[model samples]
Target: MFQKGDYTLEIKFQGDMTKKIVGVYRASYFDKLANETRYVVSTKFQPTDARRAFPCFDEPGFKSTFSLRVVRPRNLTCISNMPIHSEELNTPEPGYTTVFFEKSVPMVTYLAPQYVVVSSTHKYHIPLAKQAPNVEYAASIAPKMVEFYEDYFQVKYPLPKLDIIGIPEFISGAMEH
Candidate 1:
């Protein structure tokens, strides 16, 4: 924690699932088989929760590009701020796969959110409601919204792809992330 002259740092750690649902927490859904439970892994890193997800410069002013990769069960679907760049089966760990996402635009850590959802139960839909739309719905409208904003501001959106995620339990009406 001394030198600061342009260096690459890497840190590895593990976190347990939290029932309280903060950053990188687990969510459970009841299955058709009565007592069976299915779990989904998700992240909520707005404000200051990004630290819980990983070791980073957590402040908003520290903008940086992010390349995210996730490894999970083959049946689960992974979504992040950027589109999927590549996906490959994890041969050593059967029934698992690794997904790599495109690098994000320079952004504060708080805006990055990642989700691993159950393929069978998770519903992906294009939202039509103005009040609150599902993630897929929000994502569907992002291009048009970006066009409007860019036209109004005379500036282009800096990201390759925009993503909108819907959280089951969110404190804010909608997070920019």
Candidate 2:
């Protein structure tokens, strides 16, 4: 490499959406009411899986902010570490919509959140649509949890919002992310 005053790095790669339940995989659950199996795509980038999805300095100390954009079917919705900045409902591809998320706070590659494409009826926190009623209890208690943390830590929580998603199947009971 030659000496450089400024440089830009770009990497393009493709990864399969696998059924392994790890690192950008597809998941499915049977919907008895719907009388069919519904599928969703989600990510689990903990421990170093982020690199499997895209090129990155996949280390905790290598912190960086991320701006995410995702294109998905109109019937599906996406979620990530940050709140949505804006959305483009109309695109060249019919029946698809593009969503842009706010730039994330500087974070490690592992903590970096990934978006999931799930049914619009399934809200972020609870993926099992039939159990959507449980969302209210979590919503009611979350503010108290955050308030307790802030008081205990003696510092305000940093992020604009927090998403607590319940993947139908996950390897871990919980992730700090």
Candidate 3:
């Protein structure tokens, strides 16, 4: 490292798919009736896995806003930390689309980033009470919890929205980010 003035850094690179399902990996589900295999891509970056996904300071103390874009097959749906800002269809490649997400609030590298591309067949549905659906139950209680926390701390929730995702393959039990 040399001088420490102001600098603009741009990194362009591709990451290989992980077979063991860690730090941004592909997942597949097989449908017996349809006789097809559907694929989804998801990220699990906690502790230090974020560096494997992209170049960054990769530390909890280093905070920044994140603007994420993903290009994937048109049939899949992409979700990220922030809501979709805009989407560009059929550019650079056929049968693929680019999705741009809104800029996230200032947050640590670990908490500020997430991306998921799910197969169309893997639709999101609210779970029933009998199913012990943690995601659905969390969704129902998040708003109230946030409100209570804000009142207790005397501060508003920092982000425009709060997202809670359920990863069936998560290794750390659960992660705040």
- Say which candidate scores most in lDDT: 2
**What lDDT tens digits, residue by residue, belong to model 3 across residues 24-135?**
8887766454577766688877777778788889888898888898998887887887888998999558888999899988887777558878766355632334545677
Instruction: Tell me which of candidates 1 and 2 scores higher on TM-score.
Output: 2
**TM-score per candidate, chains pooled:** 0.75, 0.86, 0.81
lDDT of 2 by residue, 84-130 (tens): 99988866488888998999888888777677788655554343576
- Give per-residue lDDT, candidate 3, residue 20: 61
Cα-lDDT of candidate 2: 0.78
Pairwise lDDT winner, candidates 1 and 2? 2
Off by over 4 Å in 2: 1-6, 121-134
**What range of 10 consecutive residues in model 2 has the weakest lDDT sum?**
119-128
Judged by whole-model lDDT over C-alpha atoms, candidate 1 comes out at 0.70
The pairs that clash in candidate 2 are: none
Compute the lDDT of residue 60 as modeled in candidate 3.
84
Clashing pairs in model 3, backbone N/Cα/C closer than 3 A? none
Please write out the lDDT profile of model 1 over residues 44-122, one tens digit for every residue.
Answer: 7777888887888999899877888888788677777688899889733888888888888788888864555544435
Q: Return model 1's CA RMSD, one decimal.
A: 4.4
